[model samples]
Target: MAIDITLIHWIYISFILAVIGFMLFRRDTTIVCVVGILTLAATSTLSVSASITSLFNSFIFAITELLPTILVISIIVAMSKILTKSGINEVMVAPFSKIIKTPTTAFWTIGLLMMVISFFFWPSPAVALIGAVLLPVALRAGLPALGIAVAMNLFGHGIALSGDYIIQAAPKITADAAGIPVLDVVNASIPLVITMGLVTTITAYIILMRDLKKNKTYTSTSTCSSSPIEETQEGLMSERMKKILAISIPIIFVLDVVVMFTLNLQGGDATALIGGTALLILVVTTCFAHKKRGLEETTGYLIEGFQFGFKVFGPVIPIAAFFYLGDAGFYSIVGDYLPENSEGIVNDLGVALANGVPLTKEVGVITLTGVGVITGLDGSGFSGISLAGSIAQLFSTAIGASTATLTALGQVTAIWVGGGTLVPWALIPAAAICGVDPFELARKNLLPVSIGLVITTIVAMFLV
Candidate 1:
């Protein structure tokens, strides 16, 4: 059966190109996505009223699909805020400061610690966890703030997030779009993720070392001031409570992982376990921190958590909605007035292109990698991951490729780019904390990350 490339498909491709162009100029794609959705609906329905309804339906569909990720992230962030306020976050990483005795040690130690912590709590909160404590230690040991930022960025956002082995948020989105089990994406990403992490981090370390040799006198004192850690006075009772929660939180998450493996839990089951544990920890921590005001404070924490989740997801909604139309399962959300037996625009286009154009394995590899990179231009890292997954499924089906490996390849590329390693704006948290220029940090990361991406892509071709 030959797949016909329709005008609607062309429009979708055009809008995607436009979005990529805007992102290259460092512009937000929210409006472009909105226009794309309206255009898609209008073309498919040929009725203004139907198009308006479709728009709303698309948003609803996106939210429904992504609610789990948003919620888990929100809850974790809220828990981090509580920990920070109660001084447990500082205590958690305080021991790491002792191990940074030299510049080389500081670089690898801080980076490794960030990777481990970020894998569990996420890079955003992990930044907060390590920034104040370990950063000064790294700086004191002769590693420049920019170097520290590179280590943190590469390890936390690039490595931990790209794989997302523990949290599984990235894998969930990609697997759902690929129509595979989350464990498939998770298991498949392990090698690619390791390759990217090692190559990028090592390259970055070499660059930092070269810079350091050029300017031996460039110590932490010359470029930046040591930020003093804040002290919070508390009764012995409260201090003990902090110690207990600090120890308890990490253990609980670790046990959750253990239970997950023991029970053969994956996908929503694993996600539910993590979410439930986070909520429980949040409640316990909130009560311990606010004994007198526990009831009122718990409500406030939940509200804040929900707010943070929605806020972060706000831009992602429209972007995901536009991409969701590329999946056949989501076609109904876009509009029901299309021709009988209508297929997704991207899927149909993939089939048409595959049949009309002879695609070698190399070409398939490059196309998927390019699409992942293009989607990552939005700087959200996550918004385009699902698109990559969906496109991976289409490409794999069209060419008889390894679907899991290709999907993992796309997921890793999208995240490493948008997850904050290559994107300047996305690197703000680490940059701001380390007091380095975000652009400088991004520039420092460019070569290493690019090299890593190329190597990983080639490796992906073999896997597929």
Candidate 2:
């Protein structure tokens, strides 16, 4: 049966292409999304007033749906700030510095520790924590600053943030868009994440080793002697308090994880546990560090946390609103205001594709991968994931592929690209900390990340 493609479907497709074009040109997508909302509304409703109202509602709905994730990421980032102020973040990774006696050990140790810390605290904070305490050690162990940057970028942002297993923020966003359970995305991502992580990190390590051999300037005696650990002022906390909080924080998070597994908490339940614990830790640590000013300090920290959270989400909300309209649930929110029996533009398009398009699994995987990569070019990594999820949901139904596997593939690719490994601007934190150019760091990351992405994509074929 041939499915009829409506005007709305073509409009949606056009907007998608416009978004990609905007991203490619390195332009802001917020305006494009805003325009898309207007166009979608105008096409779906005859009344101009109704179209405007529907547009506003879509933004509101997207915010309501994604608020929890924003909150979780904000609280976790705030907690990291508290830890940094208390010097606990530095203390947390201090022990690992002792294990870095050689270049090989330094690379693996720094990379693995970065991966672990990034999982819990996020790469933004983890970069500061690892860089302040461990970078010097890795440098002293004969790794170049560029090499250290690669390790942090690949492991922290590329692998940890891409998978985002511990925090579940990335999976939550993708899962919500796909209209599937978050655990489905989380579970499906495991194998693909591992494959990408190993391939990229190992490839990077080999490249670094070959470069080191070529340039004797990176020898242990020469490189180790020059780099010294940079010091920063610790906030108003006693040494004992710092030690206590450092120990307590990790233990608390680990226990949260164990409890999650014990109680079989998967999606929002798991996220709530983590977010709530972070809030508690933030309070406790603030009180201990600023006893006289605890009340005022806590408020300040909360404000700062919320500020950072909203700042990150500011660009994301409008983009997400445009994509959310593609989902059936969100569409209903706006659809009710439209003409009778108006359907989701994207979902309707999906139905058409499923019936009319000649989509095999191979074609489905490649097209989705390309879409994910293009969406990621916006450099937010996150902005594109919801689109990927929506597209994955559409294509999976069209071709009889595993929705979870497809969604996971899209999630991984979008994140790895925009999450920092492939994008120069996104590579700033890791690059800056190591005193290397962001573009140079991105260049080093290109081969390893490219190889890893290809292998992971191939693995995704089987999963799909």
RMSD of each: 7.4, 8.6
- In order of appearance, the predictions have TM-scores of 0.65, 0.62
| Prediction-by-prediction clash tally | 0, 0
Give the number of colliding residue pairs in candidate 1. 0
Candidate 2's TM-score reads 0.62
* CA lDDT scores, all candidates in order: 0.73, 0.73
Q: For model 1, state the Cα shift of residue 461 in Å.
A: 7.4
- Give the CA lDDT, 0 to 100, for residue 198 in model 2: 96
Cα lDDT tens digits, model 2, 1-464, are: 23356666677678878865665454667789888888878876777897789778877887786677667656765666666766777777677667888889988888898898778667765665466456655776888888898999999988899899877989999999899999999999999999999999999999999988888443211111222222335558878878887787778777865776677665456667777887888898888878989889888878876766565456556766776665453455456443244344443443344444458898777766766675665455786688678878988887899999889988999889878887655665566556564445666788898899889888888889
List model 1 lDDT by residue over 389-458, tens digit each. 8777877887898778888988999889877887655665676566554555666788999999999999
Q: Output the number of the TM-score-best candidate.
A: 1
